[model samples]
Target: MFNINYKSQHPIYEQIIDQTVLFLMEGVLQGGDKLPSVRELATSLGVNPNTVQKAYGELERRGYTENIVGKGTFISSSHQVEKDLAHQFKESLKEIFYEMSRVGFNSDYIQQIVISVLKEEEYVTDTKS
Candidate 1:
């Protein structure tokens, strides 16, 4: 289930990769889960086949998926944490926090905002991140 947003500044291939990672993180997709063919996904998302291929290529390079000849692509059997994605996510958060600080948002205020969002999203349970 890919959600493509043409109006967003983000590229479609990156969105596909992001959503795939989210699915893995949320346990909606697990080790050995089969992914649609690039052609199928491209047709479904109304994107170029090369776009889907690029996304899948990046995912494989990050060790998130495996492509076996004739069998098709699948989620990695080990399903280990994607280090590149984690690093990039942390770096992006750092940039956001820096921007927030420049705008007068203190650490405590930012923490509160994070806590509120986590709680509202049902990701909090009396424990802080």
Candidate 2:
């Protein structure tokens, strides 16, 4: 469920963190879903177990996952987890918008693009429904 690009500029741990969060947000991973053990994930990804452990630690710190002494790690169901994820997404979007503005993108153009994308997604969802 996760892919690692050794040549990518992004660190392996960061990639793991991002993928886990994306999975959670997309509902591919729901609350109480067991995450792969560090050893299993490390072996599958061909990375050091330490890296996976670090990613899991970060997820736990961010309230995305919780560890049970004997049951392995599972996704958290706390409402705060969703709120935190939303806030993180908003901050990332803000950074992207600021970068675009720095490169001469105007607010009107940005709004139009965003609205267009949203409308297209809504259309797709409606058709699927």
Best by TM-score: 2
C-alpha TM-scores of all predictions: 0.66, 0.72
Worst 10 residues of 1 by lDDT: 77-86
Candidate 2: residue 83 lDDT (0-100): 98
In model 2, pairs of residues that clash are none
lDDT by residue (31-115, candidate 1, tens digit) is: 8899999999999999999999999999989889999999999999762555645776798889999999999999999998888
RMSD per candidate (Å) reads 4.1, 4.8
In angstroms, the error of model 2 at 95 is: 5.7
Question: Per-residue alpha-carbon lDDT of model 2 for 1-129, expressed as tens digits?
Answer: 999999999999999999998998788998889999999999999999999999999999989999998889999988877897789889999998999899999998888777777778885343211
Off by over 4 Å in 2: 92-129
Badly placed stretches (over 4 Å) of model 1 are 82-129
Query: What C-alpha lDDT do the candidate models reach, one value each?
Result: 0.89, 0.90
